[model samples]
Target: MFKILDKQELAESIIEYTIEARDIARHHHAGQFCIIRVHSHCERIPLSIAETNSQAGTITLVVQIAGHSTQELAQLEAGDSILDVVGPLGQPTKIGSPRRGIFVGGGVGVPAGSSMVRQMKQAGAQVLAIIGFRSKDLIIYEEKMRAVADELVVTTDDGSYGYHGLVTEPLQERLAAGEKYDVVITVGPVVMMRAVAEVTRPYGTHTIASLNPIMVDGTGMCGACRVTVGGETKFACVDGPEFDAHQVDFAELAQRLEIYRDEELRAHEAGPHECRLEQALKELG
Candidate 1:
């Protein structure tokens, strides 16, 4: 069992957990994620490793309480043991000697891409990070991203704070202003990533997008995480969670993301599901 060493609420419904996963912490790289099971019989969910401390043998996971599984995870507290914490999975982001790079993230995606942004800066590349949220209240990881990036721009769709626009606006403005970047990496809602891709396509900027698909198993054995990149089938679990943005079929990806929408709604309406242990403890009490 992996112990939850610490926990913090980053934003409304967003929780960050520092887990004691020794080997995973030591081997983890930017862009890799972990599949966590809160308790036996609970469905597993994929979460990005926002940060890691190899010496401390811990990895950080930022989880947004979206559905049943994530809600169950949020119920866990520090010192609780997770039933399963399997990972260091997925390919690491390729930061191949870029002179300048732009990292775009939104909502929970901000923390998701924090490690990648930090790594890029450490590699001697000038990094500009653009992070967005629905409103000021939903913002997270501002200082974390700012500390590692050369420049940080925060946007909010409702004009509640920062740039008061979508993340793509700043990106488009920069590119249009003759600002050049060796690479642009985006992680967020599908529509946002697609928009960012379109903004950079005309400039021929090398853009990569991290994909979130329905994944089960996380080891490539379960074909659930398959996505279309450049018309070829690729599994996000093994082939990549990050792919060339221009070549990705965003329409198909957006459609696929809705596959379990109805079921999730029903599950949510039924209320949070507890594992057998929780029920047993309640019964005994």
Candidate 2:
């Protein structure tokens, strides 16, 4: 059992949990993720490794309560035990010795980008970070990001904080201003990533995007996380949670993500334990 050492509500419907997973913390690198099971019977869900502390023997996961599993995870308190936490899965972001790099993260993606920024800075790259949220109330990891990034630009769609537009605005503005970067990394909603890729493509800047698709098993065995990159099938679990944004088939990925929408809503509406009970009753009947 992975023990929850601490928990904090970062924003409305978003929570951060520090879990005691010594091995994972010690070995995890930037851009890797973990598959967690809230309980034995609960469906497994993937969460990006937001941060890790080797000495503390813990890894931090920032979760937005978007579904039944996440909602249950949000309800867990400090000292609670997670039934299973398996990971440090997926390839780490390849932060070679680039002279300058820009990382764009939206909403919960901010936490996922934090470690990458830190790693890039440590690699002697000048890192610029652009983080976006729906509003000020949704923003998270600002201070953490600022600490690692050479420049940090925060944006909100509603003009509630920082720049009054999407993260792409600042990125485009900088690129248009003749500012050059060796690489661009974006992690966010599919649409946001697509926009970033489009913006960087004409500039001939190398871009990487982290994909969050429907995943189960957290291993190559399931093939549920399979995605087409450069017209080839690649599993996000084993091949990547990060890929070349320029070659990704975003439309196909977006459609696949919605395959279980109705079923997910029904399960969520039925409540976690209640859904299990209904299944058990159906079996007996």
Each model's lDDT comes to: 0.88, 0.90
- Cα deviation at 166, candidate 1, in Å, is 0.2
Taking the tens digit of each residue's C-alpha lDDT, what string does model 1 give over 65-146? 9887787788889999999999999999987988999999988888878899988887889999999999999999999988
Clashing pairs in 1: none
User: Where does candidate 1 have its weakest 10-residue lDDT segment?
Assistant: 276-285
Model 1 TM-score is 0.94
lDDT of 2 by residue, 1-285 (tens): 999999999999999999999999999999999999899778777999999999999999999898777888888999999999999999999968999999999999889898999888888899999999999999899999998899999999999999999999999999999999999999999999999999999999999999998777788986778899999999999999999999999999988777655556777888676444234324434
In lDDT terms, how accurate is model 2? 0.90
What's the C-alpha lDDT at position 34 in model 2?
A: 97
RMSD of each: 5.4, 3.5
Screening candidate 2 with a backbone cut-off below 3 angstroms (N, C-alpha, C), the clashing residue pairs are none
RMSD of 2: 3.5
Cα error, candidate 1, residue 208 (Å): 0.6
